[model samples]
Target chain A: MTTLPTPGAVRLGLVIDLDICVGCHACAVNCKEWNTGGNAGPLSDYQPYEAQPDGVWFNRVHSYEVGDGPAGQTVHFPRSCLHCDNAECVTVCPTGASLKRAEDGIVLINEDVCIGCKLCSWACPYGAREFDEDVGVMRKCTLCVDRIYDEARPEAERVPACVSTCPASARHFGDLGDPASDVSRMVADREGMALMPELGYRPTNRYLPPRAKGSGCSAHAKSPALEPVMPEGTGFLGWLDRLLSA
Target chain B: MHPALSVILFTVASGIGYGMLMLLALFLPLAAGPADRLFGAVSLGLALACIGGGLLSSTAHLGRPERAWRAFTQWRSSWLSREGVLAVLSLVAIALLTLAWPILAAPVECIEMTAAIAGLLSAATVAATAMIYRSLKPIARWHNRWTVPCYLTIALASGGLWLDWAGAATGVDFLPRAVAPILVLLAAVVKALYWRHTDGLKSATTIGTATGLGALGQVRPLDPPHTAANYIMKEMGFRIARKHAAKLRRIAGGLGVLAPLLLVIAGGMVPALDRSAVLLAAPVATIGVLVERWLFFAEAQHVAMLYYKADAV
Candidate 1:
């Protein structure tokens, strides 16, 4: 009764470029805006203008300083559902609610069947699945399946909200199965890395490493060097320094 | 590991239950003549009660109790599935043994040997049950090979004691009181070995390793990502005191090992109170093991502990 994973019409996935990302969080904002209005709506913010704030976000950006000394700098990494090839989340669900699509390789959740046991959430190490307390079901990134396949939407704008609103064009979406696809070419040209490869989750999303910076491309180059100068007011320490130097 | 009470009760209660059944199955065949239907009936009844109690307790842990039957569908991949299957097999064997006792009474050689074989099968079921928890790779403490033997020891020790009491109450000397001493020694050694093994095991991942950087320098969290505790922290980052932990370990050692050993030794010296010593040691050992199992869940460190800033990832 066991069957191998069948080849689908489209293998939907994402490619995130670390080089051009500015960490402005516009993608996160747009994602919240679109998803809140669309199928997975109302991200449930605890309080908008309160002392303490907490809410569910589809995309979260992390800023880290890597390298050392002159070459050390900040890199912004955005994280979301990887939609792994060997998804433990799907298999761990006891209610048969979590499932992968045969047509496009996109993983989805059936809210009606979900018992909210949170086993699927625990199985996933990426912290992708979110529990909706109001509905008593698990929620996750659907890869915007409803919008992409909509015939009414324009061809150019037929992509995820995060990808469409990326101001720096750092996010790319396509089928990676074909070698000639833009995502495949990008991955081939620039060495793309999967997060937590050792875990063997086999995430669908791939991250392209930042391009190396050229000579004289440092951010802190404009700062002036310290120079010795005479003090306006004379102090005991100043007098001591003068006496010692002489 | 979250200390889901249902699972704890299931493992402990069922362990005692199935283990007692194994003891009954072992002794039934040894009668000088045909098996006593009355004695056989009592043994089978106690075994069913224990298994039934365990199954009932485990179901309470599920969020949706109605959907509990769905868990048995994934037997190919889950240890929980195998445990269920083995429990059923043990139940069926007990039923068969009970029914045949009245018809097959009398013959010392045949009865004793069949009972011994049944006892071994029951023990195998206990081991399989323990292996369910031991198989998880993410939890370093439970995944070790020692989990199965430790569980088996607890079951044998507890079940043997209960059998002694039942036999005494019914005015039948079915099994030896000497089983208490063996159980005590075995339980003591198993606990010691488990402690020794876990002490040498390394942390699953370091903070540096979690970040995908090979840096050797000390890394501390400058700021936690969120103010409220997430699900991961609540489940995996439970911290217990080192001093209290050491103290509890001593208590578990005394109850699980030392007390039972003393009682058995006393029974051996004063032959009059042999039954009493075994009966006393069994409850003491169960209480001790319950405490031990609680600590096992509480003290276990998960790889996700790296995210909570408890240590170097």
Candidate 2:
């Protein structure tokens, strides 16, 4: 049951644009909020108001400073389950609790059957699965399976909680299995890359690279021409007048 | 890579149990008179106790120990499941052989065949256990060609020590005292080679590759995602100081391999001290192997740590 389905079979995934992400963490926050009460609900938090607080979250945003000095740019990376084509997390589950959907390629864990041995988390190279200490089960990004397929919700707003709530509009969700799909085209056009492609998990999600520094119209863009300021009068009188006027 | 006590205990205890079971099977046909019965009973008892204790300890770490029976259903895909099935099979075979030994009287061809089958199954179970760790591609330290042989050798060496002790205590020379020493030395060399290989290993994936940002110059973590350590960090971010690891390796090698070797040789030289020497060697070798197992988990770096700015894993 843990064996993966054939590749390119309705691979619904996300394309995150790193160029537009503002490190706001809205996606991660919304993800926690929606999933805490959703299918994998009550993502437990321990010591909420104490000195050390720990909890299970399906999504997390990590910020990094890429490059150096003036050329450096802050890159906020949100990581979650990639819903890999060859998901080792699913294959390594001794109880067949971890499963990948052949229909939409959404990987999920059956909480009732999960022994919570934590092997899936270890097998996952992306650090996606979270262990719910309180429930004694493994939790992870379901790609909002409860929300995406819910007919009661408006069709336009039925994307993943993270993608729907991203204020910067940095996250896009669509069928990655189709080359012509919006998300897949976005990936192709933006040259989005798979995280840790060398490991060969064949992650469904893609990350669009940030634009080159000084290439776009921004406040930091240098002006080609400059005009020197001239005082109304020459010498000490002009300098004193300019200083007083400033 | 938390190196939980339950897992360390499980691997070590079960390895020793299975090793002893295999050796016992090989020696069962050579036994004569009541001594054969005594040796069979005692060896099988020790084997069963260790195996059963280890299996129980393994379940302790699971959230739902009661549901452990479900683990056996996935042997086709999971090594852990295969290990469970194999352990049960080996246990059944060994139990039958032990219980039927008295009724069977002297050595019979069928009994020998059964013992041989049980021994092979026990060895297979240990191999399955080793594969559980070795197949994990995410942990660079575990996924290697050396892991399987290292596990088998250690199991054989530890079991050999116990066998020697059991034989000496009963005044039954079932196997040569030299066998244990030879096995210990072989295990030592393999373990040393494994250590050297891991020490020189450069992680296949780097932080740059992990994030798919190698094109961006020198990506460094500006801030972690959470204020406090989360599951990923807690489970995979475990780090041990270099000096401490080196010291533990020395202790493991010296106590686990060298000490046992010396004791076994000493026991051979002095007939009177044979029993005490072999007895002392068992515990010493066990402690040494325990240290080795601890380091195995402590030093393993999971690939997931790359997200938290681990340069390589």
Weakest ten-residue segment in model 1 chain B by summed lDDT: B210-219
Instruction: Put down candidate 1 lDDT per residue, A1-246, tens digits, no spaces.
Output: 011156465678889998888877888788878887888776666565676665666776655555666565566667678777767677656556777777777778776566666666656666677666555567788888777888899998888889999999999988876778899889889877765666666777788777777653454576576665756337898788778877
B1-313: candidate 2 lDDT, tens digit per residue? 7888999999999999999878767776676633376666677788889899999999998988888898887787888888999999999998777766644544576677778888999999999999989989888889998899899999999899888777767766776657778888998999888988988998768888888877888888888998999998888877763349989998998899889888877877898887898889988999999999999998988888888965746
Pairs that collide, model 2: none
Kindly provide the TM-score of model 2 when superposed on the true structure, using C-alpha atoms.
0.94
Question: Tens-digit lDDT track for model 2 on A153-228?
Answer: 9899889999999999999999999998999989888899998887888889999999877744445466665555
Distance from true position, residue B136, model 1, in Å? Answer: 3.0
Clash tally for model 2:
0
Q: With candidate 2 superimposed using the best TM-score fit, by how many Å does residue B230's alpha carbon deviate from the native? A: 0.9
True contacts kept of 2: 0.75
Docking quality tier of candidate 2? medium
Best-fitting candidate, scored by lDDT = 2
